[model samples]
Target: MKVIRARSAGFCWGVERAIEIAREYATQGKRPVFTDGPLIHNSQMMERLEAEGIREVGDYLSQTSLEFGLTDAEKQRAVMVVRAHGISPERRGYLKQLGMKFRDATCPDVGSIAGRIKLHARKGYTTVIFGDPKHPEVIGLMGYTEGRGHVISTEKDIDFLPPLEDKICMVSQSTMFTFDFERLAQYLRQRYPGALVFNTICGATRERQSDVLVLAKQGAEAIVVIGGRHSANTVKLAALVEKQKLPCYHVETAAELDLEQLGQYKVIGVTAGASTPGFLIDEACEKLAST
Candidate 1:
């Protein structure tokens, strides 16, 4: 079997920087250092970090606990690391209020999006974000609005607003696919001619998605999408591959791929999330090729 890997698979610039920062923090051998969530969306990557003594905090899906800040026993000693997804301005301020050593590992792309959101909010434009309402990046973006904006998770939610009257600014979570954002933005502009739209989808995501299709078109028989299940961008990429009627497995590690499933394909395509590391993709591809 010939294994084909997406050239875009693996760590993005932001993810690489975040991991490097975390490694530096881990080398310090700090106590009870915690990421607000899994620093990235890949469970395999998170396990590797945990094995290195870096602990994970709240569940990435629906976990929002300020316990890291409130634990009296761990208060002054614990080092809290903000994940790459970043946190709300309020959450960051609260984390600081606890008087604990803190490490910020928010991806630069996300920070830039948050800055744009903040800028729009400060300019008196009621912000509207495109993404899951509960997602950390969306939550962080919403925080800049200071309770003045709304989050539209799906296209149907677009119609929920009344006839547009207030100055509105529309931006997206950094990790969302460009197609989805574009479709929604196009519709919103048609519905309300004055809606200000900002495209915040990271360039890496755009390139990765475009390249995944290219790999599939090159006759990849089976596809391996390596990333945490809760990773929106990863899931979307896998879904896109599936739409091409190719067999795709969304997994965090190579162990999850059954020998039988892999054996069924002659050309296996590999892809990953922005937060995924190159080592993980390489391991999976090596296993597939060896089989």
Candidate 2:
């Protein structure tokens, strides 16, 4: 089978920078490096970081109390890195109170979204975030909205919103589909003509989404999306493939590929989430080419 790999099938700049920050601390050895959550959504990469002495200390969402049996000396030598997905202000404060050095590895793109929300909220605008409310980035952005923030994922979500007398400002989670965000933004404007909509999806995300179409144009019969199951961006890539009317096989690793089923395709297109590492993408492409 012929294999075509996407131009943007690996870690975005933010994830790479976050890993670099943690690894730098891990290598120093003077302090134990820890993250509030999985630094990125890739489980395999997290395992590798674990081997490098970067430990995860908090829950996946960065919620709940963290329990560690550390002495004062240990706490003094510990460093806590915020995940690339970022954390709410409350979570940030809680993590800081743990008595470790706090470093924020939030993607600058996410920070910009938070800044926009914070600015609008201070000006008496009710912020509406188009994202999964449970997503750490969205949860974090919500913290900047003062007390007037609403999370919406669909038109119905917008419909169910209460009548807003305050001015409205809208933004999106960094990983969402561009078209979906635009569609909803239009709907939001129809409902609230004065609403301000900002498309905050990162450039890397747009590149990855565009490459899926590039693969189709290259005559791929099926598309393979490689990333962790819990990776929101990776899941969206697979869904986008299906939206393009192509067969999409979403797998975390090459081992999960159904060779028998995949063999039916003469040419396969491969893409991965922003959180996916290059090694995994290479392995998947190699395995498919071998078949």
Candidate 3:
């Protein structure tokens, strides 16, 4: 069996930046470093950071509680790092009100989407987000809409949108599937002729998905996608592989790889989500090579 790994697999620029910032703070040993949430979706990465003395605090929308067993004084004194996904403006304001010292590690691409929503909303345009509504990125985006935004995951959801007298501005989560976003954009164009659509899916996501497509076309009998189960981008890659009618397995780490099943394939493609760490991808590749 041969193992072919996607060149674009593993951490993207944003995730890399976030991790770098967290590590810098952790290394400085300053003020009990804490992230607003998991720095990234990968559990292994999170555990590694925890072992290094960096910890995750509060949810995106809520305040930091005694969840980390930190006393009020500790919570107040600790430096908070906002996760890559970003947080709602309301939450930012609330944090400010509490006088918490925090650093914003929001990805530039995601931050741009929020800025676009705010810009359009100020001009009386309703923002339409194409992605999972419950996602932290989308939630932060909705905060910029000034209550004039709607979240829809599909073209069908577009039908349920409230009637809009003004123009509509449509944007998508940075990690969403590009094809899905385009399909929905096409539908919105036909339904609302004046709707403005922005392809907010980041270039890294496009590259990762494109790499998987190339692997499928290259006749890989099976594909292994590595990433956290909760990672939206990683799940999409696995789904894309399955859509190509090839056997695909989504695993969080090498331990989850089904060696017995994968041994049957002559050629196996390996790819990972944007949030995946390089070491995890290396482990999967090593395991496959050994088998």
Candidate 4:
């Protein structure tokens, strides 16, 4: 069996920045701090953070040691973090209403698109967001404006879009495909002229797609996309591989790989999510090779 790892696999710029910020804060004695989410999609990273004094808080209203859990006393002492996935603007206001101290660790690229939405909206352009509606990133972006905005998973989702009397501003989640988002943007323009599109998909997403596409093109018998099942970006990469008709497995860990499946392929290409760690990739490689 031959195992080839995608050159552009694993942690992206945003994940790196978020983790670094958490570590920096922890080092400064910010013990019992609460993150809005796991900080990233990877369980290993979450466990590591828990060991370092950072507590995980999936929801602000949860019973965890977050701002929500903090009595009036702890709210004045402990910190509340907006994770990389970010919280909605409404959520931010609600947090404020709770009188919590928050440190926004949203990626700069993500923040830029949200800022631009405000700018373009001021210029009379309606905004269209490309992503799963349930995604935290999308939820956060949507909170940025109370104006007219539409969310779409495909161009067909916009087939019934209202006539553009003014203008259109289309943006995407940072983990979406550049090519797909552009194609969707072009479709919207064909249907509605005077529409503006911003490719908010991050540079890291493009690299991961490009690397996996190259692996698929090289005739790899099977591909393993490693990431959390809930991770939208990682799932998107897996979908990209599937378009090639190659056998692909989207697994969170090496333990998830089936030995029976390995028998069907000789060349296996491995790729991982932005939140995935290097060691997870290495473990998958070793397990896949051994099988």
Candidate 5:
């Protein structure tokens, strides 16, 4: 089978920056660098980072309180990093009380969204976020809404909301589909005239989304999406492939690929999420191409 790789497949600038921040502390400071959650969504990369003395300290969602016991000396030597997905202001407060060196590795794009939300919330705007309610990024952004945040993933979610006489602001999680966000924005505007809307999906996410179409146009019979199962952006890529009426094989590693099933396709396309490492993408592509 012929293999076509996406130009914008792996590690986005934000994820790369977050990793670099953690690595610098771990390597240069020679201290254990701990993150509130998985620094990035990819488990393979996290495993590699663990080997380098970077450890995960909190739960996957960044909701639960950190339970590990650290001595005063350990706390003084350790550095706690906020993950790329970010965390709520309340969570931030709790983490800071741990008395460790604190570093925020939140993506700048997410930071921008949080800043906008904080600004409008101070002015008493009801914030409507279009994203998975459980997502760490959405949860973190909600903290900026000052108790006026509502998360909606569907049109029905919007219909169910109570009347809002106050000003309304709408924004999306950084990895949402542009079309879905715009459609919801239009829907929101119809109900709340003069509602403020911001398309805060990062440019890298848009580029990756657009590249899936490019793969389809390049005559790929099927596409392979490589990333962690919990990775929102990677799942979206698989869904996007299915939307194009092509077979999508979503796998964490090349070993997960069903070679017999995939062998039926003459041309296959490959793409990875922002959190995916280049090594994983290369392995998947090489496995598919060699077969």
Candidate 6:
């Protein structure tokens, strides 16, 4: 079998930065360190961090308290690390009110989108987010718009939007499908002629998606996508490959690969999500090569 791996597979700059920051904190041996959420979507990486004495806290106040598991006195000595997905401004303020210290690990690309929304919202514009409303990144971006933000997963959702006389500013989740975002942006502009649109999807995501499209077009018999099940970007990659009419398996680790299924393919392509570690990608590639 011929095994081909996507060059763009594995960690992007932002996830790498967040992991580096967390590791640095872990080595300091100072106060206990906790992330606002799993630093990234990969469960294996989260487990590795936990083994290194780093922990994750849930988003809700009650969940945070439970996950923290520290007394008031102990809590005062803890340092919280904001995840790469970032948190809402309101949540940041609430953390400050609790006298908690946190280090922001928000991706610069995600930060820029939030900044743009806040700037436009201050000028009385409504923010339209082309993303899943429940996504952590979108949740954080919405905070910048006060109460004037709306989320739409598809172009159809735009029809359900309340009529807005105010100017509109649109941005996308950093990991959204590039083509879908453009289509949605076009629809919004047709309806609101003066609406401002920003292509906030990260370059890494675009390149990864493009790479997979190319592989599928090249007639790879099957494609293997590696990442956590909860990873939205990984799910999108798998869906994109399937849309191309090629067999695709979305697996978290090499162990999940089906030897019998993969054996049927003479040439297979491999790719991974942004949050995936390089080692996991290598392992998957090696497994495919062996088969």
Candidate topping lDDT = 5
Clashing residue pairs in candidate 3, if any? none
In candidate 4, stretches whose alpha carbon ends up further than 4 angstroms from where it belongs are: 60-73, 97-100
Error of 3 at 257 (Å): 1.1
Model 1 misplaced stretches (Cα beyond 4 Å): 28-32, 59-77
Q: By summed lDDT, which 10 consecutive residues of candidate 6 come out lowest?
A: 60-69
Candidate 3: C-alpha RMSD to true structure equals: 1.9
Any runs in candidate 2 off by more than 4 Å, and if so which? 60-64
Better of 3 and 4 by TM-score: 3
Task: Quote the positional error of residue 117 for candidate 3 in Å.
Answer: 0.8
Model 5: per-residue Cα lDDT over 37-65, one tens digit each: 88889899999999999998764454556
TM-score of every candidate relative to the true structure: 0.90, 0.97, 0.94, 0.90, 0.96, 0.94
Cα lDDT tens digits for candidate 2, 45-147: 9998898899987654545566487888898888899988887788888888988888899988888888899899989999999999888888889999998
Give the runs in model 6 whose Cα sits over 4 Å from its true position: 28-30, 60-62, 66-73, 217-219
Better of 2 and 3 by lDDT: 2
Looking at candidate 3, what is the lDDT of residue 137? Answer: 91
TM for candidate 4 is: 0.90
| Candidate 6 clashing pairs, residues 3+ apart or interchain | none
Residue 253 local lDDT, model 4:
86
lDDT of 3 by residue, 1-291 (tens): 799999999999999999888777677566677787788999999998888777886676456562566677876777677788988899787555555567888999999998999999999999999988878899888999989989999778999888886589999999888888999999998999999999999999999999998898787899999999999999999999998998899999999999999999989999999999999999999999999
lDDT measured at residue 127 in model 1 versus the true structure, 0 to 100? 80
Which ten-residue region of model 1 has the weakest summed lDDT? 60-69
Clashes of each: 0, 0, 0, 0, 0, 0
